[model samples]
Target: MTDLTDRVKQAAAAAEADSPPPVTDLAVTDTALHWLQSRQSYFTDALPRHVDQAHFMSVALSIMPALVKCTHESVHTAFLACARFGLEPDGRQAAVIPYGDKATFQPMYQGYIELMYRHPRVDSVHFGWVRERDQWDYTPTEPSPRDFFHKPRVDLTEDERGPVILAYAFAWIDGKRSQVIILNRAQAEQIRNKYSGAYKKAERNAKRDSAWHTDFDAMWAKSAIRRLVKVVPTSHELAELLKADDDADDTTTAPPVIRGTVIRNDDQADNADNRTTWPAAAEPGSGATADTDGGEQA
Candidate 1:
């Protein structure tokens, strides 16, 4: 009887050792691993090499805690899906790189569009980059002001019409239909200038910057989606996901989770009333403005 018991215990221990540990305590398993492998395989011939299994796993594991903090859930199948969409928990905002470089895996503009459609209240999300003519032609009606002090305004004048735009607007049709629009001339001009400089600088590899300049719509879409999602009230699950995003932008070297971009905030920058002054030529007739109270206009 004693011999039989010892043999059973040894068998159990051996089986346990042979099996792999859970990917994370929250929930990833064979399914997530298999899914990742399949995705990596699908992108085999793509220009920028897809992230290897090891790098993906590293980011996924590091982001799990922030996931828990945001949603009270751990690593799970949905989290895997989220990670697959370029939303990394390691604090790397979508870093754009040249073809040969290790491209940053952050949320794609398209991914955010899909996410908005999935929301119960959001009926549509529209994003675009437009010149004066297009922006003027399709200018949306302004919302009525709720505050007594602020009066409603009229359409843009001929002089004000030509301002370049990176527009992000959405419609909600839950009960009473409503809409929100955000136009960020500041970011639009900033991104344009950066890309234009890159285009001019890259003599040998001009194609990359040229493509970037031509793809202004996508650039605007990405910025719009990032800003809009942060402003809108979402469910706890989505909010938790965004918390990871928020943490990634933290400048502190010793942040709790992984961080990709480091923004050093000075005393002035941290204040709510202070406008961020970018060191560049200001656009004519442009100033920091907000549509919603206590929210960024751009």
Candidate 2:
């Protein structure tokens, strides 16, 4: 009798553990959609830091409200020219400066560590994903940890862990939006080609799931439905509440560094006075279109 009672208690505890605490609102999905519509510079604006601690969105491109032309490099160039024109004689350093990755992936781990360090005080941060490749440089024939570690550049598989598709990034719930925008790109074109399907699917899911949950079938029977929906902006009573945005800056937010990529800037803070504040465009540039490889590098 006592043994039966103990077993009942154990089973109840397991059931409680299995259920997540009452599904506290899906916030990520909604804000990203709105922010994607009308981007606000205040969101992307970072509080200037040292070079080592600097994380920036270099404005690789911009898709305005109406037409569709991605003015990435050239616009960024214009921004720089504006900065130069507005350079101050007696000035403070600018919030943004040129950025590049001299050491590959070092910033990634460092950024991750810093986030972890902020254990309990973290309010919100916006994390983004950019799937760059589809296949690993080397494929593993076995299922061992080492197989995963020293995977063969050839002989890849059709697993989620196989190749990356479209390396994309958007807003998330960290401290700030694009606070840690990660750009994990490789030099392999085939890698980008492989995961193209997954990225497209992700984009589609993002769009569809931007609203509240609708599909009832998955709640009942599916084994693995990601069921990821963005937290709705309407849910937040506080405009000050951390909101995920999907603007050109957010959806296509680029980190200062990726695979040794570098951006050089020498502007002062007062230069904001002269910077061109163009509204979000509709499409990418004449040279820019939906990347045949997958999503654009924005």
Summing lDDT over every window of 10 consecutive residues in candidate 1, give the lowest-scoring window. 144-153
Q: How many residue pairs clash in each candidate?
A: 3, 55
TM-score of structure candidate 2: 0.18
Candidate 1 lDDT over 1-298, as tens digits, reads 0135655777777778995432234333333333234333222222123345456555554433323222111122223334434343343323322222112123456655555655688766655445454423333444432211111123655455565543745544454333444557677557545544343444345554432354555556665676677645465545544554343222132222322322221112333212222111112124533222223333
Against the true structure, candidate 1 reaches a TM-score of: 0.36
Candidate 1: Cα lDDT at 90: 43
TM-scores, all models, native as reference: 0.36, 0.18
In candidate 1, position 230 carries an lDDT of: 60
Off-target runs (Cα >4 Å) in candidate 2 are 1-45, 51-150, 154-298
**Root-mean-square deviation of Cα positions for candidate 2 versus the true structure, in angstroms:** 23.9
The residue-by-residue lDDT of candidate 2 on 112-208, one tens digit each, is: 2233224343343333222223323322454322232223233334354443432222223344432222223332223223422322433566642
List where candidate 1 sits over 4 angstroms from the true fold. 1-103, 135-164, 175-179, 188-219, 230-233, 246-298
